[model samples]
Target: MRTSRALASPAPSPQEIGRAATLALHDELALSPKPGLVTLTDRGSHADMDAHTFMRSLFALRSYFVRIAELGAAQAPFEALEACGIAAEARMLAATQGINTHRGAIFMLGLLCASAGSLAARGLRPTVDGLRHTLTQRWGEALARRALRPSALPGGQAASRLGLRSASAEAALAFPTLFETAVPALRAARSRGLASGPARLDTLFATMAVLDDCNLAHRGGLAGLRFAQGCARDFIAAGGAGRPDGLAAAAALGAEFVARNLSPGGAADTLAAACWLDRLG
Candidate 1:
């Protein structure tokens, strides 16, 4: 699929990049019956956040993406780009009343947004491969250094405590999960003629099956993470969203996850990343 509606025009503006990113986020939040994650129809496994909270968070983050994209187009330093992320996190916190709604997205999708801007600056189309290449070629060293910096966030702390790879590590390596796993799964689903929503659910489950979700480990330890992975594997084994009972199977798995207090937040972030990349292509 083509990345843009108007490929004949010049590079996209910062506002255009930001709007695409925000809409991708909204689509992720709205995907219903997502196992062990928040969705428009229900809170899934989370009690502190709901669809409304996600909406508020998205509202607060609209301009942050644009500003970061502009910074990328200008070839700003990593610190300047990070500053935009910091401010965006503050806004997200304020909107969710300290609920930590979209912090992971702020990091992963924020970098992709910047990568898109960098592509535009070079007169390149914002294809998925282009975005990944721009991220590594333009900011690979900086991301490596950033990965070594100790994080104070709960997710970061949990990742360190458990010895799981940090999100920063993934970014430093150009997001193997997004590129190798989630995006491929999403494309496979769409290529099979699945609608956007079902395709996204399949992508989410595919991510959940493979991701070492720090959120699940944080909340339920290794056992919980394993259980989540097992459920995901079973869902996919049963044909994922392709089966007539696929959506129902997903909903049932979600109920089981909630009972165990297992929320695959990391997998959810990966789903959002896949959604963003899909929009780009």
Candidate 2:
């Protein structure tokens, strides 16, 4: 009798899941020419933070991801997960000396890591759909309630003022953008034989085109958000990153975003979540 291939490989350990989450964030950080976002080589729209600041924050949060995964594997309640996230955010702020480098990632990716852990604990192979299901089944109600509460964060405040979809709402919806838009865009680009760099560029633009990025609203208001969306649409219309001059065009867009101080941090987080899902496979 031959053993099944799925049985031959064990489910990823909690620690491994945590490490993958960290690397997924690094993937987002390394992707350059991201309109109004930070990269290893440039600070796209921020005057207070650079690559070094992000690096410190990443280093600080490494253990938090592992702990959150452990909690998820134990099937802990949403409050437990929220507590872990709150602690992680504090560490990140401390590491970056009060600069919020990975605040959004802490919430979005932290929940994702927890969902993956839940799947692994049940002897289930973590797929995109499995993770989403686990998240909704386990914590969707809590997330919905969270969406109803007032937020003190600048991005959340901006989203409220503009009547845009907040991060909490995205989580309550089980991250429709991450599963529906960003992941599909990434998978499609990769299947089309685009390199990692170009594939991510295409995915980023695809996400930016649709995400109600609160960071853009916070920085430059509704007009700025619309401007970023228009730029993203133009990029996608121009054949995306698959085109010969696609990367060049993306870099130029990044310059324009910086000039206007518009940053699509929400879209960046979604892209990182998609990357994490892809890596889980």
Candidate 3:
């Protein structure tokens, strides 16, 4: 519910812009953690280290939410990492006793990152009051069920149907494409080459490699998402006998953005990924 303007883009350069984004993210993580809860800030402490990591992870919940909510699947590799952490805690909390307090705290943080207002709102206010209703209705129920059922994760049949499973699989397969194809293609297009992105190559590249694969697999129904893998394959190549890259519609917009009329080296690929997800939705 904090009010602040998103840092304007058309930024100095991809390096500068992404650096700022990363710093902002870390800042959010530092400030808004769950009070009196174990967290990353407690790292290296002798006591409650694991609990601290779990809770510290929660403290930065807003950063996680803002990243996913604003960036969508394209740039969501960052968010997915956090989401997985939350999933792990949720599972642990369900099975273990004497940690109910920490369990509820983690769940609230998860809702903050996963629900409508969390990722869907794009740095705006959390709107998916549907989340609040669901939490109120099912959180305790889920806890009770976990006790009897002994299953750690929630969402039942709904999780797979929601496409996280598929996305996870798809993201697995997307590595060759993202690194071999997309990154190379953009580097060739850019005058900057690898120099344009020392920082992003390590973090963003690895993250995008995962996210793109997941988004494709899950078809998580992102906004502005459409296009297929092979659809743009020919376009990325040298002379396709027609257009350079055959990206059209959402894909075309993505390609152009990747080509640098948009933001940075990875921006176009990420944006295109976003466009494709939008179509699925």
Candidate 4:
């Protein structure tokens, strides 16, 4: 779907970028209380997670996201894969899923969130989808830029990156990568008759609404989503069951951001999570 609305105009300038980076660093340092394991309580109880633990998880997740924003700004192919020490995977995802680092980040994050929901599709520590997404977006964007131009990327590709380039081709939905990431879970929800079409719209709206309810400005509290997603990711890595309430909270907040940006059409993942949480609630 066409995104008539843009991502809330990116932080005004590089100064803002610096501030964001600083804040992100601060948040990660704060999560040191919870080290490796993230606990998600099933009943009306939560494992005692302290500030430090939370910060560590946040720090790890930050790398996953900043890499995304950076990829979005990339201009070449060689640099893309090398952006985060992940060039080969970018090529693989591109070949298999038509995803570059730009699109891959979204696809991967969505997959992580969805996998977290299931929690035990396998007993192994699940791959951190967000991390993979970051690697993909970095390289993909570099590749996209290379395809757009003919130049040595951060690294550069020998051959052109495009298999098909059509003026009529829809611009890839790489923005809001989570939309792509969340597609599988969204589809499963629909197949199980657990969701409404474009269900993510409601989830996005609901997310924004909840944030509004808590007096958290969308810009200010976006970190909360990052933090929460990190916590969820770590929990899954430790084989913890999904937290229905946490899932709902994340979806509701996601909806809020999309609704405010006027791109509610791309909320399939958010809504699907909301449906799952609602059912599990």
lDDT for each residue of candidate 3 in 183-269, tens digit (9 for 90 to 100): 344444343333322212222323233333322322223221123233233333323212323213323434433332121112223
Candidate 2: C-alpha lDDT: 0.91
Top of the candidates by TM-score: 2
For all candidates, the clash counts are 0, 0, 28, 37
Model 4 over residues 1-281: C-alpha lDDT tens digits? Answer: 65532242222222222234334223222221121212221101113333344344334434433443333333224343244424334443434343221222233332222233222222222223432343345344443453465434311121123222211111122323323334344444455553342233223333322221111112224453344344334443432222334444434433443333321111222333333223221
TM-score of 4: 0.24
Candidate number with the higher lDDT (1 or 3): 1
Once all C-alphas are superposed, what RMSD does model 2 give against the true structure?
1.0
TM-score of each: 0.95, 0.98, 0.25, 0.24
lDDT of 1 by residue, 174-249 (tens): 8888888899999999999999988999998889888878889888887898898888888888899889998899
Write model 2 residue lDDT over 72-165, tens digit each, in one string: 8999999999999999999999999899999999999999889989988988767878888998999989999999999999999999999999
**Top lDDT prediction, candidate number:** 2
* TM-score: model 2 vs. ground truth: 0.98
lDDT of each: 0.87, 0.91, 0.31, 0.31
> Between prediction 1 and prediction 2, which has the larger lDDT?
2
2 versus 3: better lDDT goes to? 2
